[model samples]
Target: MNPVDKNHWLDGLEASVERHLQHAIYYFQNQDSEVLLKPSVTGGWSIAQCLEHLNRYGHFYLPAIDRALQRHDGQPDAPTFTSTWLGSYFTRMMQPETGKWKIKAMKAYAPPPNLDAHAIVAEFIHQQETLLALLSRARRADLTATRVPISIATFIRLRLGDVFAFLIAHDERHIQQALRNLPVSQDIDVQAVR
Candidate 1:
């Protein structure tokens, strides 16, 4: 288990979100549309599709988080958050760690093919900004007590902190997934001539 600083975990996570925003910006600015929209080498989602998938989650989660925060408007933040066992399990499952495990996306979250790469990238940037704003709001609320409904089941709720952790980890997973899907350059041929 990683040590949690009582006062700084959310702030640290906010910083992490900022880093993700910057990374996405770099990708959008540096990568051409052809690269961004190319189908994965593994014949799965393209980079744009991966990002749209994240955006689709944002559409549900961001509003749900907003409502959760509003409902707990009077609650004070605890000195530290300790995630529920189930919440912790779900969060851990989404983390990219070694990227060895691949979970199939539910049908509802999958992005359609041939989406406009530029538009999808822009939407992702906007959503990340919205997430950061929500995290800032979260620091003043009881994150462990604030519950957001899971996308799969509206009745199944997780703590706000866990939701953020899961979403952030999920985003990282797809970002790396999209990067991996980029077509490999085959121009270099270094055959060993013995």
Candidate 2:
């Protein structure tokens, strides 16, 4: 991937986080437990499961990001962020638009059936807020120099900017999956929600 201005990159990511947060507030919060737990017509995971899955990831990445930021506290922010080859590969694989292959979730991250809709939605909202704050804090740190370990493999780490990119893309992928599981009668306007 080409180098991107740090501020511009963060701004785009922040906007994405805001949209996800708003959707959780306006849409998911309004749904009843039954609707939220309803499985897709093709027999996929429920909305609640999708969210819980994301929440599980947030449980790992959020703290990892915080720790990385703290460890690199005095570092200077770079003018631009250039994604590493591996980082770019991971980000592209997580993106819903570019990622056509459906990868199975790790056993730990896979959410089971019968999750509480309200709690899942609430946690998701909290995590999104936390992500926003971290993104803001990241302005003071060097995106290229900082590294965060991937949940799947602790020994391997990616640039802070790549972590943000892939993590948000993963969130979007599942959120869209969750939206698909929504009942047709609910008449959700996905575009307008953002």
Candidate 3:
């Protein structure tokens, strides 16, 4: 087995996410914003654009979870995977493998003309910190019981033990994409997560 597999899955993922975030913070701190924000390829999101999209979408899981947590009220009970039409769609979305969906969605984002890399990185850090706060407050039981907002048949193969695992993977997936989309940043090297 890979050394990564030996670690509890979400624990390994959380460590990776922290490392990735450190690289991003350092990159933004030192990088020349104009160069990083400049359009790299004709048909792609620029670094600033990619960062904006990640900032917006990485919280996909947390808002709903926060609502549930607020209502959790210390009872042994919490909501199950109840499917509203929108909820079903949410489930379908959160169910994809390590960002197969995120890449597709990222392709669809175009940065507005006025935004700068500085704004994008600032937004990214703010959003990531919010997500980390949510995760820190999440109870372990919540992690296990939170049914993925998905159909069982879809998840049976992965049988993800909890929502936290999925959320951690979600962050890492987008972080990887943003790193790839970034035009070279100041001396920092953010190798793609293997």
Judging by TM-score, tell me the better candidate of 1 and 3. 1
Top-scoring candidate (lDDT)? 2
Give the TM-scores of the predictions, in the order they appear.
0.87, 0.96, 0.61
Q: Pairs clashing in candidate 1?
A: none
Question: Candidate 3: global Cα-lDDT?
Answer: 0.51
Regions of candidate 1 where Cα sits further than 4 Å from its true position: 1-6, 182-194
For 75-159, candidate 2 gives per-residue lDDT tens digits of 7778888889999999899988899899999999988898878999999999999999999999888899899999989999999
Worst 10 residues of 1 by lDDT: 185-194
lDDT of each residue in 1-194, candidate 3, tens digit only: 11222125445545655765675686554566775566545555566766776665554445655655565447463222222344334334554342245435543343564567786787777766766665555433233344434222333322122444555555555555456555543332444343
Model 2: colliding residue pairs: none
lDDT of 2: 0.91
Per-residue lDDT tens digits of candidate 1, residues 72-182?
Answer: 998776767777788777777887764457789999998888788888899999999999989888878887778899998899999888888888878877876776665
